[model samples]
Target: MIKKLSKKLSVSLSKSLDGNNEDVEIWTYGLELLLNGTIKFGLIAGLSAILGTFKPTFLILITFAAFRCFGGGVHFSTYPRCLTFGVIKFLILGSISNVKGNMFNYNLLFYVTLFLGILTIIKWVPGDTEIKPIKNKEDRKKQKVKTTIVLILWIIIVQILIRLNSFKYILPITLGALTSFIFITPLGYWFITSIDNILDKTKVKYGEVK
Candidate 1:
């Protein structure tokens, strides 16, 4: 049963990556990915919803922006971006909670954090042999600047949310921010490694790297 499920999921993911479906169809596929059985994704989504509960529209926009900036390929796909953002957001929120002496609601935070950490370790343990070295210094620098600016903007937004006494909505907003940070941090590294692996495998299979 587990094998069958895994195979099914793998096929779905591959199809989504292949971009064979219509735009709307592809978007639905991405949504399925985000909504699938993943604790990290759930926590991030839940937290985002909760934080933006008072202002759901803004919360959604924030979530979308975080996913687009931190997680790659946000234009037509959403699932992967959401999952990536969720894991990253949770990690950041968890860290902030620890530092600020705030007793966070542990039920979701703890489990998601643990799950992501474990997955990261497993993914990296074989030594990230798949990561492609960055060859373009200018592109790398541009990316760095863009990332830094986005992060700064996120921080400012969070502060504004807090000032507005969005305390009741803190969980979701914090989760969103944390998820964004995670995407740029460890989760981001994992994503890069995964992409490199895919590209390398494709090259080997097709006799050329695109």
Candidate 2:
């Protein structure tokens, strides 16, 4: 049953990537992202479940997805890249927890992991070796401020969610976060990239390549 579902999902996603129908493509893209994210989070949740820390698993997944929606989406613009990062991050978190002998304090480890991940993202910023002028200085400043505000809001919400033991609402929260992150970040990138490739091929076939 799972395999059948996965096959159908793949076909649907491929059709969406074709980008012939805008509305249907957008909806399909959203579903693709959600499914991919859910699978990734499910893997982490399974690992946590094995270690008897299921609640934190769901919480961590939500927090990670929220952050990805805001930041990592622009940094790693590929579904495979995002999945790779997710797997690496989970391994690092698990290894550090093992070394510290504190599985219950996974939240602390998650924060540390996120901090390091942010630093990594910054290090990979485009044009790091070259200086570029802001095309619209005022607009750039406003965007920076907005991004900061959104980040602060996200942090506060995460804190409240943790305190309220929202992790206990595991399945739904996981699904929501997973769905949002997938569309807004990795899977969205994949959809765009696939369309670009198809367009490039079509242009070439018509002798319109530049």
lDDT of 2 by residue, 1-210 (tens): 333455566567667676345645455556666777787777777776787655544554555555443333333434555566565565444433333323255466336544544343343211111122334545444534543454456556656766786543332333333333333344445764565566568778886532
Q: Per-candidate RMSD vs. true structure?
A: 12.7, 11.5
The list of candidate 1 runs beyond 4 A from truth reads 1-61, 67-134, 186-210
Instruction: Give the C-alpha miss distance for residue 61 in model 1, angstroms.
Output: 7.2
Clashing pairs in 2: none
lDDT (0 to 1) per candidate: 0.47, 0.49
Task: List ranges where model 2 is wrong by over 4 Å.
Answer: 1-20, 73-81, 94-143, 150-210
* TM-score of each predicted structure versus truth: 0.36, 0.43
Poorest stretch of ten by lDDT in candidate 2: 124-133
lDDT of 1 by residue, 1-210 (tens): 333454466567657777443644545545554546355545655664565432432453465355344233211022354356445544444444333223355335534633543442233221211223334556555545554555456556656766785554555554554444344445565675576567668879988654
Best-performing candidate as measured by TM-score: 2
